[model samples]
Target chain A: MSQALLTVIGEDRPGIVAAVTQALFTADCSIGDASMMRLGGYFTIMQVIDYPRDLGSVEMALDPAIKRLNLRVHLDPISSVALTADMPNTRVTVYGADHPGIVAGVTGALAAIGFNVIDLESESSGSAERPLYVMVIQGYAPEGVESVRKAVVPLREREGVEIGVHPIEAAVF
Target chain B: MAVLSILTYPDPRLQRKAEPVSVFDDDLHHFIDDLTETMYAGPGGVGIAAPQVDRPQRIVIVDVRPKLGEDCHGLMVLINPELAAWEGMAVGREGCMSVPDFTGNVIRAERIQVQAQDASGRERSYECEGFEARAIQHEMDHLDGFLFLDRLVSRKIDLFRRKQYQK
Candidate 1:
């Protein structure tokens, strides 16, 4: 029932995951949740892993493995305490002609209003006719959606692009 | 007709290629009614395919007009559709009932021309663009036994956290 968070970042290369995961498996660690990505030349990973209840306590066990990987590792033993889960959130996707400061300006406004962003993904597409910048942001309003609605209005006016925000609840199969 | 239970993933029924309608029969009509009812009953579900309702037939109902600002042509029922040709690729995040609890970036054709049959057995061709095209393509993939998961660009780019709503 002990949980730990592991993050791995390095130059994009094969066997990085295999090396890291093999270490976890050898230690009898079970990966509970994880995400890995390749951004240009960098590879990054974030994961939550669980270990046996009596696995050599927290700091003592993870140090040697951290040194061996020659990778930055952070470990925080999860507490049994329960934190109130945040309200379910939604996603908004915006894409149009590319322009400067799109991400900084939009994200700046969002962060100002205390809207917690869960994930934000962006990509560029289109040919010479008009290069496009597309961004999809998944965020939540812990205080409720009214503030989120108000905060985004000015963005729409200044950005000259449409923003679509909908409350999305994950469907359980 | 009543709201039918949506068949989710891990249901072997969703993976099989849907059978084409051979002859117009009462069974076909009944399936259409159920699909319509199920589409409307689900929250924000603008379309439904036969495989979603366990019928394994090539049929779909779509109505995107309700999505604000989308302003798409309303109410289309496509039966036994064939993709003639399509142009352009668009990467967009798509979610499905079958895969519930996940959404991923999928690259799909932005404009498509399809030939299909209507309820009355009339041959019809459609030139669709924008969101309508996306919905049509999503539904048609079901007929071919393909899900949005198969079209994911990369696991790193499109995965998201499941949001919960507060009372």
Candidate 2:
């Protein structure tokens, strides 16, 4: 079996997953690491699957998802990715009245300082008139956590958002 | 006392509820000592449960000073521990020796009061907050056959690769 990246998007519905997965099952493909969720009424899936056949077989297997769900799909043949030793050890949470450039300015500053973002989850919790954007990022920042705490200070002040950087505590044993 | 081997995830023994200790004698004291030794022997170990070492009994050892700094109770050996009361809530990341590969977000009470017996069968109670409370709840979960993965935040696959960032 080999690995391939498959992405799918369509109007949110219950059968979207069942349809796609059933097709893959029939094609002798099994999913590995996957992220499937609904974003603003549009359902999306980004996953790596271990397939028994070639990329064309995957496209053929996804025919049901396209025709039945009226979805757009893309299948890419990608080799298994090499993982870096680095994993996210810090948790950065940003929240403020929704505005443009919040993601850009904040992430840019952290990136310039060599922060590798591992997992990020963001959402707007308030109304459109008073939008509140909140994002939590997990990353590796080897340049010192104090510098990480300071990296987004300017952006926090300028955008009137709260940006907190702290090491993620892992409770072992 | 010897450092017993820890049981990793998917071990059916870990899912069984640990029996409550009815006797706290010399055997119990020695078991607690071995548990303490095992907790310190594991990489980044700070808390452990008896079932983790194939001892299906309500016992746990914890010392969070290494993780939470000086604000924690140095070393606690809780037998048949139970959460007496709890208040507030917070989400924190946790990794377990049993669940070796994945770490995930768990939402637990911020402040907690616990009642349990010591090795000598002496009753004791503890009041703690923050990471200390979280650690106790985590260990107690083992007594009830639950891991952090069972109480994940929002239940949206919050699990992540457990990584070591110690420099």
Which candidate number has the best DockQ?
2
* Sliding window of 10 residues with minimal summed lDDT for model 2 chain B: B158-167
Model 1, retained fraction of real contacts?
0.03
Q: Report candidate 1's interface RMSD in Å.
A: 6.0
lDDT of 2 by residue, A149-172 (tens): 888888878888999787876666
lDDT tens digits by residue: candidate 1, B1-167: 98889888888888889988777778777778878888878765777888888888899887776663456667778999988878766556678877877786676677888888887768888888766788889889999888888777752343322333221
Error of 1 at B78 (Å): 0.8
lDDT by residue (tens digit), candidate 2, B32-135 = 98999998888767889899899999998888888877888889999999888888766687899889878887877888899999888899999988888888
Worst 10 residues of 1 chain A by lDDT: A164-173
lDDT of 1 by residue, A102-151 (tens): 78777787788787787777867678678888888878776556666677
RMSD of each: 7.6, 5.1
i-RMS, each model, one decimal: 6.0, 3.4
Clashing pairs in 2: none
Clashes of each: 3, 0
